[model samples]
Target: MEKKHTIAITVEDQPGVFTRIAGLFARRSFNIDTITVGKSEKQGISKMIITVIGDDRDLERVEKQINKLIDTIKVTEMPKKSAFIAELCIIKVAVQDKKIRDDIFSYAKIYDAKIIGMTDKTLTMYLVGESENIESYIRLMVPFGINEISRTGVTAISKDW
Candidate 1:
């Protein structure tokens, strides 16, 4: 059975490194669900969190392939039960009427989302939560007219040190 896997990779901070890493996935015909990269705690290094759906065998193969890349320092596949994962999402919704805007605010409050930016034509919200919670918020915002959405893919930490 196919399962969702979150892999965290620590790599050298060099130009085209991301391209090379992504190429490995493409070469295997894997469709990445989400990918987020940022500077790591160590200097001249970066951390990448990638979420993909694949069978256990395929995931093991992918992990091995990633390890062979020159720039990759380490790769860890987080265990589902022992991982604390969260993602950030920003959603822009079109709100032309006052009542609709108020309703949106009410929903945001219920979801613990913050109205970070707003204009007569758009309302931007910042939400941080588990993947499912973010998806749920996006689904609820659909009827309000979602203009655009930006997400930082799942970032996970091991529960045990």
Candidate 2:
């Protein structure tokens, strides 16, 4: 059976690191569901969070392959129950009228979405939470007309428990 897996990698902070990692996935014919890269806690290193769907056995093999890469310092598959995963999303929606705008604002309040920008006809909001919550918010906003959406792919950190 196939299942979703979140893999966290610690790699050297150097050019082409992402390209090499992406190429590895491509060569293996594995689809990356989501990926996020940023500076890690240690200097001269970076952290990459990648989500993929594949069989457990195949994923284990992929992890070993990734670990063999030159720039990779460590690779670990984070279990959902043992990690806190979240994504950041920014959505712009059209404000048709006062009632529509008010409704949007109300929904935003309920979802804890912060209004970051506004214009006579548009509202831009920033939301950070689980992907499911963000999807639900987008669903609710569809009727009001979404202008655009940009999301920082899922990022995760291991829980202390």
- Name the candidate that leads on TM-score: 2
TM-score of 2: 0.96
Q: List the candidate 1 regions with Cα displacement exceeding 4 Å.
A: none
Query: Per-prediction count of colliding residue pairs?
Result: 0, 0
Residue lDDT tens for model 1, 72-160: 99999987788888999999999989999999999999999999999999999999989999999999999989999999889987797
- Which 10 consecutive positions of candidate 2 have the poorest summed lDDT? 53-62
lDDT of 2 at 61: 81
Provide TM-scores for the models: 0.92, 0.96
What's the alpha carbon RMSD for model 2? Answer: 1.0
**How would you encode candidate 2's per-residue C-alpha lDDT over 11-84 as one tens digit per residue?**
99999999999999999998799999999999999999999989998798889989999999999888988999
Clashing pairs in 1: none
